[model samples]
Target chain A: MSIPQQLILTFISGGIICVIAQLLIDLTRLTPARILVLYVSLGVLIFAVGAFEPMQKIFGAGVSVPLIGFGANIAKGVREAVDKDGLIGVLTGGLTSSAAGITSALLFGLFASFLFKTKSKRM
Target chain B: MDSKAKKQLIKKHSPSTTILKNSIMAFIFGGGICVIGQLLSELYSYFGCDEKTCGILVTVTLIFIAALLTGLGIFDKIARHAGAGTLVPVTGFSNAVVSQAMDAKSEGYVMGVGAKIYTVAGPVILYGLLSGVIYGLIYYIYRTVEQMI
Candidate 1:
């Protein structure tokens, strides 16, 4: 696809994903945290069904930035690992594949804690 | 006031005007973040990183940026306006985790910061990993059945 087309696709898909979350927030009692976890589980299901790659290709960051993308990432990792290393990969693949993102988050979290004193949020 | 009267009064005061603005802000901010992520992925691909590595790098970079912003106290401001726009991204995960730690730093390291850091985000990790294992098992079963066929 052309650059503009790709951009449009990304915007639409990303907007839809957020809109769905917003709808849940408005219409239901489910907290955002719970919805977020549901999105990840949904992502894993999408990945298992082999639809995630197509969505990723069309929407790029739109799909990939969402929590569902994270689930898909884990699914992809495990699939690849299992193909190569059997059942062991099932256990290790998710962590190994997601290691970079997880580790960076922890490291940055620690660094932030050390550098900044806690301040109560002000409305 | 009667209970029904009070309910009506609250509903009357509910800010419907804010919904349009909130949705628009979410679209713009959320789309903007995704655009940046797309650009990062494109850059990594251009640099000859494999697809998986490129994705990992983009996620890591986004999380780092989110954590930094949370530390600087900017993400919260943006989040207040952006709503689901900011919350929908993986960066939000970083923000959620790091902000808790930062918020708890006042109480001390071990109990305050460490114990509470995952207060909200712990579920994301726990459930995400659990779903990963489940998906893996399903995939394995599917593959085995296909082979038998």
Candidate 2:
């Protein structure tokens, strides 16, 4: 797709994600943990069934922008590993690939936590 | 089953904290897990394993470390320190499974290990499945239109 198309897709996708996440918080009893996992897993499963292919093709970043994109990456990594390692890839492919994102998030989170004082509920 | 038993469990896990600490912890804990992964990958290659084998080690190592932390009760402490951070790792993933299992100790091993463990993340799994289906259908329809155009 064209650059313009890609940008538009990303904007829409990101907007949709934020909107849905907010709605879930306002409407459902589900915790944030459940929602984050849901978004990631939804991305993976959608990509696995070849459902996200069109979006990915049209708006590569758009599909990849949301947390779902990370999932797709995980699925892709696992599939790639399967060809090389067969049975073993089934176990480890996702972790090795997603490790960076997880780590980055963690590092950034820790740094942010250190810099800012988070309120303690009990206190 | 009794309030005393429930209180016992809470004591075992750390008490809840504020959202700020939770997010802060989320970042650190998640970051820590990632560092562990890097370390594991290095170890894998250090032992002369191929990329495939290293990949397998990555997951195993992450899960094992997480399980160990959970068993040691460090996971609960970390969770208290960085709420979502702890939940975001492979280890965090293990904690989610085991913590619920701990809650269901009265249900016996099979039910506790198999059924009850998923109680915490079940809704997330269900929602993810539903969203994936919805997103796929939407993406497919739009793609067909683009192809025709």
- By lDDT, the best candidate is 1
User: Top model by TM-score, which number?
Assistant: 1
In model 1 chain B, which range of ten residues has the least summed lDDT?
Answer: B15-24
Instruction: Give the residue spans of candidate 2 off by over 4 A.
Output: A1-30, A42-70, A77-123, B1-22, B121-149
- Report lDDT per candidate: 0.83, 0.54
lDDT of each residue in A33-121, candidate 1, tens digit only: 89878988888889988999998998998999888898888888899988888777789888877778777887788789999765557
Per-residue lDDT value at B88 in model 2: 41
Q: What is model 1's DockQ versus the real complex?
A: 0.66
Evaluated against the true structure, the overall lDDT of model 1 is: 0.83
Question: Model 2: what TM-score?
Answer: 0.49
For residue B51, model 1's alpha carbon misses the true position, in angstroms, by: 1.3
Show the colliding residue pairs in model 1: none
Clashes of 2: 7
Residue-level lDDT tens digits of model 2 in A24-121: 53356457676667767877787777777777555433345345655675666665565567546655566556665444333332232223332223
lDDT tens readout by residue for model 2, B1-149: 99999999987896543444343444444444444554565577789998556645665556555555554546666565554444544445555655555555556556644466567445544454444444444444555576699
